[model samples]
Target chain A: DVKVTQSSRYLVKRTGEKVFLECVQDMDHENMFWYRQDPGLGLRLIYFSYDVKMKEKGDIPEGYSVSREKKERFSLILESASTNQTSMYLCASRTGGVETQYFGPGTRLLVL
Target chain B: AQSVTQPDIHITVSEGASLELRCNYSYGATPYLFWYVQSPGQGLQLLLKYFSGDTLVQGIKGFEAEFKRSQSSFNLRKPSVHWSDAAEYFCAVNGGATNKLIFGTGTLLAVQP
Candidate 1:
């Protein structure tokens, strides 16, 4: 079974604070993604990593960055957290050729 | 650009009743289609996928979906519904060579007793 795990399930931070959301996958997949989900808007891609040290921006990448120092771990960083950044963050990993992705339990971030 | 649309925003069905959720996509070429379910406070889970061959694909939890190329639709159906089946369902399509997925707004399902 492919298991993707997030560092935190829920987090609360003050405005302007830097936030880090970590994701790890056990399937040795080459692709990792970060997404922010909102009501009515659904899940929007934030950033994705195809290989170690290689990252690409998705639809909404402002105020957010990513790190892929290792193949099994992908990290999302918020330079300056704002209230609008509060969302349910999801992490997913997939093999290079396959389109099917496995997701981890999301991290619900609250920026007050 | 490829896009996905799930017309029904919200749907309510009685327990043990049949179920169906509609999904439509707009793409230039043959696209990869997928159905995912997200429980409250949980991450999205893959229900089924349609790459090629077998328009009717079966998934976990007694869920099934059919892909119709003529209509550009992939609708999910279940013979019987359970209360636990209530959740947000999303339809997604591969954007292109980038291997990214474009998702619909999602439909919230409410199961009545």
Candidate 2:
């Protein structure tokens, strides 16, 4: 079974603070993604990494960035957290050419 | 551009009743379809996927989905509903051009006793 784990399940931060959400996968997948889920809006991709140090912006990449220094770890960074950035963040990973993605328990971020 | 649409936003069903969730897609050719379930405060879990060869695909938790090429639909069905099955279900499609997947808004299911 594939396992994807997030660093924090819930987090609270003040406005203008920097927030980091970490995700790790044991399956050694080549593609990792970061998404923010909102009510009635579904899961919108924030950023994705195909390989180490290679990143691409998804549909909604503003106010968010990602890092993939290693194959197993992917981190999402908020340069300046704002209240609007508060949402349930999810991380998913899959190998190349595979359509199925395994997801980690989301991180619910609260920017006050 | 490829897109997925899940028409029903919320559905309520009694236990032991049959359930169906509709999903439709817009793409140039046959696309990979998937149904995912997300429990409250948890990540999404893959229920089933339809790539090719099989129109009706079975998934975990007694769930199944059928892909209809004529209608561009991949709807999920379950013979019996359980109270624990209450969750938000999302429909997604991969167009095969890229690794990205387009997801539907999602349908929240409520199971009645």
Candidate 3:
């Protein structure tokens, strides 16, 4: 079984503070993704990394960025956390040519 | 552009009753369809997937989904609903050569005792 683990299950930060959400996968999948989920809006992609040091912006990438320094770890960074940035953040990893993605238990972020 | 739509936002079903959640997609070619379940405060879990060959695919927790090419629909169904089955269900589609998945606005299911 593929196991994706997130660094934090819940977090709270003040406005304008920097926030980091970490994700690690044991399967060494080539693709890693960061998504923010909201009510009635579903899961919207924030950023994705296809390989180490390679990143692409997804649909909603305005206030978010990503880092993939190693093969097994992906991190999402918020330059300046705002109240609107509070959301349930999910991390997923999948191998190339496979459509199935395994997800980690999400981090519920609260930016006050 | 490929998109997925889940019409029903919330559904209520009694325990031991039948349940169905609708999903429709718009893609140019054959699409990869998936149904995922998210429990409260948890990440999404893959319930089932439809790539090819089989129209009706079985998934974990006694759930199943059928893909109808004619209608562009991949609806999920369960013969008997349990209280523990209450969760938010999402439908997603992967079309073309992209690894990205377009997810639908999820449907929250409520199981009554």
Candidate 4:
């Protein structure tokens, strides 16, 4: 099984604080993605990295950024933690291309 | 532009009953279709995907989906529903050559005793 692991399963941060959510995959996938999931709206792409240090913005990337310093690790950074940024964050890695993506357990972020 | 839609917000079925989840998509040319399941707080897991070939695709956990080009629909179905089948299901369509995926509002499933 492809194992994608997130650094933290639950996190709490105060407003204006910077938050970091980390993700790692053991499958050596070339593509890594960060997504924020909300009720009714589902999961919206935040950022994605195709290769090391290469990132692209997704549908919702206003206050968030990502880092891919290595092939196995991808990190999501919240510039300033706001109450609205509180949600479940997911990380996924795909081996071949866009077809199949394996996901991590997910991190529940609470920006108070 | 590309998008996905899961019409049923929630569905309840008996443990031994048949299950079906509807998914509709909008995109130009042929689209890559996928169904994923998220159990509770876990991340979404790929259930099955349809890129071409057979319209009906078999997946893990005894699940299957059929794609209809005319209707632009990919519906997931299972013969018998187990209690463990309860989960939130999401439908997604991949558009762009960059691997950006558009997902639908998920459907929550509840299995009755």
Ranked by DockQ, the better of candidates 3 and 4 is 4
Model 3 regions lying over 4 Å from their true place? none
Runs of candidate 1 exceeding 4 Å displacement: none
Candidate 2 Cα misplacement greater than 4 A, ranges: none
Estimate the overall C-alpha local distance difference test score of candidate 2.
0.94
In terms of lDDT, the poorest run of 10 residues in model 4 chain A is A93-102
| Candidate 2, CAPRI quality class derived from DockQ | high
Model 4 regions lying over 4 Å from their true place: none
List the candidates ranked by lDDT, beginning with the highest.
1, 3, 2, 4
| A1-112: candidate 3 lDDT, tens digit per residue | 9999999999999999999999999997999999999999999999998899999999999988889999999999999999999999999999966469889999999999
- Residue B60 accuracy (lDDT) in model 1: 96
Docking verdict class for candidate 4: high
TM-scores, chain A, per candidate:
0.98, 0.98, 0.98, 0.97
| lDDT digits (tens) for residues B5-62 of candidate 2 | 9999999999999999999999888788999999999999999999999799999999
* lDDT (10s digit) by residue, model 4, range B1-113: 78898999999999999999999999998889999999998989899999999999999899999999999999999999999999999999987777688899999999999
**DockQ of every candidate:** 0.75, 0.86, 0.82, 0.86
Which order, best to worst by DockQ? 4, 2, 3, 1
Write the residue-wise lDDT of candidate 4 on A11-91 in tens digits.
999999989899999988999999999999999999998889999998899999888999999999999999999999999
Q: Which of candidates 2 and 4 reaches a greater lDDT? A: 2
Error of 2 at B76 (Å): 0.2
What lDDT score is found at residue A87 in candidate 2?
A: 96
Deviation from native of the Cα of residue B58 in model 3, angstroms: 0.8
